[model samples]
Target chain A: MPPFLYIFLGALAVVSALGVIIQRNPIHSLLALIATLMTVAILFIGEDAVVVGFLQIIVYAGAIMVLFLFVIWLLNLQVETGPTGHLALKLFGSLAAALLVTELFFILAPPHLQVKFTHEPVGYGSLASLAGTLFTDYLVAFEVTSVLLLAAVVGSVALARRLPGTDDPRAARKIAS
Target chain B: MIPLTYMMSLSAIIFAIGVAGVIIRRNILVMFMSIELMLNAVNLAFIAIGSRLGSMDGQVIVFFVMTVAAAEAAVGLGIIISIFRNRETVHADDLTLMRW
Candidate 1:
């Protein structure tokens, strides 16, 4: 990846991220976040993590974000109506974020920070190569992830399920009558 | 090739923005989005460092992170919907029924 292109993508990502937080509407924020994620995906691809980049697009931006949009529309949450939050919390939070960024930069800013990515043998970031490592070394973890995903699905369904027998107000009133 | 620090720095900046978003925003959904942003920022750093080291571990770890994030998002949004169903609001400050 060229330096200028990296900068441009970085700037685009940062700006879109800010847009995500700054929007008053959840839909707008969601759009901005998608843009940010897309830029990051581009960056990932530029860095040669092609599979991961596409996964970022398909999984994160595609599936998950679509779910968010669905819920937002389902709930009919148009725009935030109340005061944002305690102003003091906002001020302190911004301050804390600034401090955290400085701290992260300090930690990442070693003298050898300029180390560039040396060329690798063929198939470094390919899917087959990733599977080679995942299936051989992290095989158990991969299987466990499937289990984790199943558990999440079951748990979420349970939580979101509204039992009509008890949760329905009209049903309760009918019983009272 | 771009300097590793540049990529890492961008990661840090985005992560910080995410942190700020979570704290400064009152809307639970937006906060959730900010959390996703934070997670992606970490994924970017992992890929950046992994490539810098010429290893595939970073990419694989990112894959795992994405999976976990997906599950988290599912459960989280479910909780949000449930809460909103009962309380009719998604503002963190407003949902203080459990608060002492």
Candidate 2:
């Protein structure tokens, strides 16, 4: 990628990410997040991570964002009102975040650590190579991920389910009807 | 090819924004989105480093990270929904049930 183009995309991503935080409405934040995810996917693809880039687009921008939208609408959440008095907390958080980014930059941006992008290894972006790495070496971790997903699904269902005669709003509505 | 340092810089900036969002935003849902943003920034860094070194490990790791993020979203949103059901609010400060 051209240096100018990389910078522009990076700037756009940052701006969109800022929108995720700055927007008062969760739906707008969701939209901004989609924009950021798309730009990141493009950046990944440009940087020779073709498979991961497409996965980011499909898994994140496609599936995860839709899930976010579904929950937002299901909850019927309202726009977040301004805090009554949390100026100090906000100031403290901003200061800490600035400090952290500065520290990360100092550690990562040093001239001695600057690694030029090198030649792409054979099959670096191929499915066969990725599957080889994931299945052969990280097979156990992959299995564990399945287990984790199962547990998460079970747990979320248990939490979200409304038992009859409980204080669940849905249950109350059903009773009223 | 862009230097990995710039990628790292971009990741750092985005991650910082995420941190700020999680801390400054009172809405539980927005804080959750901020966490996802931070995870995505880290994924960018991983892919950037892998590309710089001509390795595929970074992509694999990002895949796993995305999986974990999916699970987290499922569970976290479930918790948030349950909390909303009980408390009738999603503001972080208003959640005192867990506070001492």
In TM-score terms, candidate 2 sits at 0.93
- Model 1: residues >4 Å from true position, as ranges? A110-119, A164-177
What lDDT does candidate 2 reach at residue B67?
93
What is candidate 2's lDDT per residue for A51-146, written digit by digit as tens? 889999998888888888888987897787665227887898799899999899888966757666567778887888889999988999999999
The per-model lDDT (C-alpha) reads 0.90, 0.88
- Which model scores highest in lDDT? 1
Worst 10 residues of 1 chain A by lDDT: A112-121
Q: Which 10-residue span in candidate 2 chain B carries the lowest summed lDDT? A: B91-100
Model 2 residue pairs with clashes:
none
DockQ of each: 0.70, 0.71
**Inter-residue clash pairs, candidate 1:** none
Give the RMSD in angstroms, all C-alphas superposed, for model 2. Answer: 2.4
